[model samples]
Target chain A: MNEVADLMVVLMAMTNLILLGTARLTLGVRLVGAQGALAGAYMFAANAEHPTVHVLALSALIIVAKGLVFPKVLLRTLEKAEARHEMEPYVPYSASILLGMVMLASSVWVSSRLPIAGLTIPPSAVPISIWTMFTGLFLVVARRAALTQVFGYLVLENGIYVFGAAIAGEMPFLVEMGALLDVFVAVFVMGVAVFHISREFEHMDTDRLSVLRD
Target chain B: MTMYEYSCLPVVFGLTLAPFFLGIINRTKAKVAGRQGQPLLQAYFDLWKLLHKGAVYSRTTTGIFILGPVVGLAAIVAVLGLTPFAGCPPLFSFIGDLILFAGLLGVMRFATMIAALDTGSSFEGMGASREAWFSSLAEPVLWLSFAVLARLTGQFSLGAIQSEIGSALWAASAPELALTALSLFAVFLAENARIPVDDPNTHLELTMIHEVMVLDHSGPDFAFIQYAAALKHWVLASLLAGVIAPVHTGHAWIDITAALLTMAGIAVATGLVESVMARLRLTRVPQLLVGAGALGVMAFIVDIMR
Candidate 1:
């Protein structure tokens, strides 16, 4: 269980960094979906035996919602809008990757201090998950295109799922489902937002995303 | 009364006092600028006036226009339930209550922005965009700042942090807290249509974002939306005060006094700032918010080191 959790944590972290460093919006969305499925697997593998119905349901939902539904919608939005690549990133790929590494290390060190290990899951899950969450936020800030930011949001949601997994028993079935659906819907709505944005501006660069001023 | 009873007061106080705060701030600005302001309770009167009247609808508006203020108020009330104003009596407490507290605020902004879009006017659209942009930056600052409080005292309840932050043990660390407090003050100004970020009196549609968006709203619905905006502003201001005030575990009177004083101080500060500073150009606003994020990050690092 420990080794598998470690691998899941590492894999998710790498995917997060890759999401940051990538310029291709399509691949970024796909990778976010992959990260989601990986997280679901981690939850299932970490607590397969005691598998409460809610746990299984949540894990399955994550795989479908985060892994599948979100990415598909984002890509479709990009496809329709004719904006598929991240152009003029605020931070270059190399720097974002390096910063991501630092964030991962810091997250691990930070998570180690918390008693998540004393809970049902491995301690690494919390920090790695938090690291991924903030990295997603970083991606949102660094990337210029609205299409690419969908990936950033997915990665953040993925991190939250990982954190929730650490304290799975503490949350109720409906609450977990609600949170999951909220993320899914928020992303879905954001996809619609990208469409409207493109309609108005003819481009979806983060710089241009700034039609709102003080 | 017990702590829970004391905590209840702040929540009730929160609901009751938001409009009055707006009244007070407007009066201050008027007095300072050498004009006789409306009565301090004029906001309450405006609410009464608007509510008694009917709404005038725009041809382009949709359901979102109606939903914006309703959801905004709901979100603020939801958030107040999570915060521990006087005695840490949050209606809902959890391990990561702080996150929920901030998240609810984000949700409010999210709803209102979309609601702004529902108006279908380019002016409203522009306001929504700026609100979204500034708020995206503001939310992270909010999260990181509260996370520092969580780490510093090793507590997560919004109320507990308020109380713990009140304790004398942390009082010596003024520099970081002051910076956090100041930056949060900036966020409160930006979030509210306060001066130096937004001029409530502005009639210029081309340059105005917040005012221009609501140009078409009137009567009762406009009143609710405006009141919600005031409540939202008060929530941010009070929370920032909690960051600076020794709100935790003090005499209920002491904590409440400090908190209210902080609120008044925030209003006065807003007026002073409006008097002294000019609103940054539209593009320049993000840099100011980024500076806020920088402060939050700095404070988080400071908390982690401590």
Candidate 2:
């Protein structure tokens, strides 16, 4: 169980780096979907020893919503927006990957310093969750496209879910469902906003939106 | 006495079989393109032909031009002595030898770059510059991957680290080893001027990185450069093969055979990569190299946390 969890964590980290490096928005959306699926699998793997109905249901929900449904929503938004790539990001893809590494190292350092009490979580769980969150936040700040930022939001939500899973072991069923519902609604709203923004501005370059204030 | 004699096998294997792996790569590429490939001994035959041909030098050439192939080959041979094969110790091993390994590679590049510069040709100089830039990005990843291995095994020397890896270490940290193997593979590709970094077979000088620099050398000098390249490829591939297939059988013969087979597999893998993907644009090359470095850093951090 621990080995499986560790492998999934490493895979999640790879996806995070790939997300940082990739320029194609569609590919990025698919990668985020795959990452969400991996996160759900990770949740299942981490809790494999004592599989409860609530945990199984939540994992399925996560996989279905984030992995399948969210990407479909994002892809639709992407199609409507017609933004093929995240050109001229605030940070270059290579630099973003390097920054991702820095964030990973810092997360590891921070996780190492934090004292976990009496939890038998997989050792890499905390650090990877933190790294995922950092990658999400960085994506949001660094990328230019509103759709990609929404991808960032979904990634951020995945990180939060993983962190919760890692720390709390068996989160309450109601809370997990509620969190999932919240993210679903949030993504729907973001998708609509991106649609309207791209419709109004004729481009998805969020940086150019500053012109409206003048 | 027998153990002492057995330690020299890696060097012997590398010297004799280095070009064979190149042949394997060419053949794999050929086969992939739906054509009957050159014989597996084509590289050896090319080396033989180049060796017998007469040398030619321009009146403008300097002594450094002649010294390039000699020093590059010599540096690679020295590095090969320090590299282990399939958990078998090398001809030489010492504390902090990984630094020496990396430094020797740098020396090889420096020798080649200066030699290229000595040609007084703008094309070679451009090649040399690109080589230096890409390698600078690649070197840190190499060091970081080595750091992960050292941390995992608590051994600094290449031989010690190779010998320490077994089923036990893989069971403990497969992810780290996988990441290290990946980055090392990238370094191997970049250093060898393989596809996706630089196309070794490209005729257009403008696009060439490593091949363009060697344009002036011909006959025996070119042969030496070619053989040196084969050996360098073997050395880097051996490092990757060590990580991917650290087959630590108790018997020396089994280990050597496994290592040889692994090298062939890697050659085939490289060929498939070349066949499948075009060489990246010059601007995109650094991104790939940097991504490899990022993998190395991620591996190191993950191993540290573990």
Candidate 3:
């Protein structure tokens, strides 16, 4: 179970890099969804010794919220916004990949320096969580599109959830359910925001959204 | 088998096998486009026919134009001697020969560039400048990759570095190995003037880099340029192959066979890239090459971490 969880950590890091390098917003969203599902699997793998019904239920909620609900909302937002591609990204794809690697390495270094004795999860879990969080933040800052920023938010949420799973044996079911609801509502609102942005601007470029300020 | 026996094989086999890559690439492109291509021996036949014909020179050009193909071909052959195939050590090895091998490519490019400049044609001059600029960016990537490999193998010679990268090094640092290989692959594509950099088939002078530079050469001179280009392609491809698929079956014969097969695979892969990808805008070429340099740096970083 530890080996599988360790492998899952590496797999999540790979998906993060893939998200960083891809120029298509749709592909990025899809890769984030895959990362979310892998995180859900990681939750179970990390908590194999202390499995409970609450743990199972929370993992399921995470998978539904992150893996299915978030991606569907973002993909629809992409469709409605008519912005399938991320054109003229703030950072180019290749450089983003290099930056992503640097971030991953730094995250691992930062996690290593942290006091992680309280978490019974594998040593790799801490690094993976921190790296995912860093990548999510990078996505939000480095991308120019609003929909991709929403994905960045979702990925950020997934990272926190992984860290929570690694530290806590079982999260309370009500808190898990409420967190999922909050995410769903946030994405719903963001999706609507994207539509409105598209309707007003005819394109989903947030860089041009400065026209709204005056 | 002994090291002496292995050393001479790559030189003989490389010269014989280099031109066939052009044929394979053409056939693969043809197959993808659903056309019946020329025979696999077409590149060889073209070279044969060209060598039999008389040389033609531009009236304005000096002797530098004649020396370009000769120097370029000699440099490539020297590079071939320095490079390892499969797990076999090269015929020549010296400390810091890796840098010398890279310098040989620079020499070849210099010769080509001077030859192009000597033609005194605007198009050739433009091509020469572009080549010089792109190659300047590409050299960093090549060196960075070498740096990573040198760190991993603790060897500075190209032969030593390549021959030492066996399954153990791969097992220990697969990600670093992969990053370096990818970096080198990008350098290979750009250096060889393949698609996404320069389209080999494009007749448009403005769209060419390497081809435009050689536009004045004809007959035997052109033949030398063609064969040298093919050999250059083979050397770069073999460097990549040596990294990505360092299959050492212990038996020298099997290792040599694996190397040959991998070269064929690289040729096909190049064809597929040409068929699927559109060439980038001329301005985007530097970004692509710089990205390759970034990959190499990342590989070096990864190796350091390991």
Candidate 4:
């Protein structure tokens, strides 16, 4: 079980790098899907013996919502908005990947001193979650398109959910439900926002959205 | 005179005292701008009157319009519980809370922005867009800054950072503190809708950032909106002050006094900035945050080298 957890941890780290390196907005969504899937597998591996119905339900929801639904929603959004590729980035992919690797290594190095052995599912899970979050942030900062940022948002939220899992508490169902509802509404809202962006500017570049001034 | 044991006290106090802080900020801004501003308790009166009045809903507004302020207040309360004020630790503290604190603020931003768009007004949508854009930049700066603090202090918890930092618990130096303090201060002001980054006193919606988003909210909802905004500033300012204040209160009265003075000093500082400067163009706000991000980078470098 611990070895399975370690494997999940490595996959988690690779997903973080892919999320950092990918410039395709559609691919960005898919990486977020992979992240969510990895997080679910991690949670399952953390405790295989006492997996309850609620755990199964939550993981299933993570699979459907994050892996399948979120990507589909984002793809349809990018499709409707007609943003085909991330044309140019503020930070190039190679640099982002390198920077991301540095961030992950630093997180691991920093977290190594912590007593994560007692606190979390796996000690590496701490840094992995942080790296996952940083990759999301890196993507959001580097990408140009509005849809890519939404993908980044999904990735950021996925990292957070994984962090929550590494801890022991069974999160209140209502809070989890509230979080899911918030994500659904946020995706819907982002859909409307993307349409508005394309409609207003006839292009979905977020840079053009900077018209409002002081 | 005693602080409540529940995590809710800081929240209730934070929420209750929010209007007064706004009043103070307005008064200072008014004096600095050379107008006799509204009374120190003017926001309180506004809240009272607004609470008694009937609400007039816009025809095009959706359920989110009604939902915005309620969730807004809820979000502020949520964030307050995540913080510690004066000598009191948070009612609850846990790992990764620093990130969770940012997440809660994002929730507030998310709720308020959605509500702004729900009104179906282009002006409100404009505010929503600007809010989302700037805050997206500001959030990472916030997380990274906190992460720096965490890395230095070796504590993953929010309330634990200061006690660890203050006791000379960590060997980190003042220059690193300088970078952390300044960048976060910038993000704080930007987050609070203050001057240079944003002018809270700006009258027109086009020229406004945070205020314009809540233009449609009226009555009690508007009161909640105002209080929530004030509470947010208070919370952020408190966090900023926490890094600098000696934090050894010696007594509750001293702690309260120090806390109040710190809050007022921040208000004055904000006022001075407004008095001395002009709002940056919208395009420039990101650079300001990025400038702050650069400061974080500098801090990370400085701390790592140390």
Top-scoring candidate (lDDT): 2
Per-residue lDDT of model 3, residues B51-135, tens digit only: 9999977799999999999999999899989888877788788899999889999999999999999999999999999999999
**DockQ of each model vs. true complex:** 0.02, 0.89, 0.27, 0.02
Once superposed on the true structure, which residue ranges of model 3 sit more than 4 Å away at CA? A1-23, A37-69, A87-112, A115-132, A158-181
What TM-score results for chain B in every one of the models? 0.92, 0.98, 0.98, 0.93
- Candidate 3, residue A34: the lDDT equals 87
10 residues in a row with least lDDT, candidate 3 chain B? B297-306
Candidate 1: give the clashing pairs.
A144-A206, A212-B130, B162-B248, B163-B248, B166-B246, B166-B247
Against the unseen true structure, what C-alpha lDDT does each candidate score?
0.74, 0.91, 0.84, 0.76
- Best prediction by DockQ: 2
Ranking by lDDT: 2, 3, 4, 1
Span of 10 residues, lowest total lDDT, candidate 1 chain B:
B297-306
Q: Model 1 over residues A74-171: C-alpha lDDT tens digits? A: 77888888876777788876567657656766876787677656565654567778888889888888888877777777788778878877766447
Which has the greatest TM-score? Answer: 2
Task: Pick out the ten consecutive residues of candidate 4 chain B with the lowest summed lDDT.
Answer: B1-10
Docking class of 4: incorrect
TM-score of each: 0.58, 0.97, 0.87, 0.58
Better of 1 and 2 by lDDT: 2
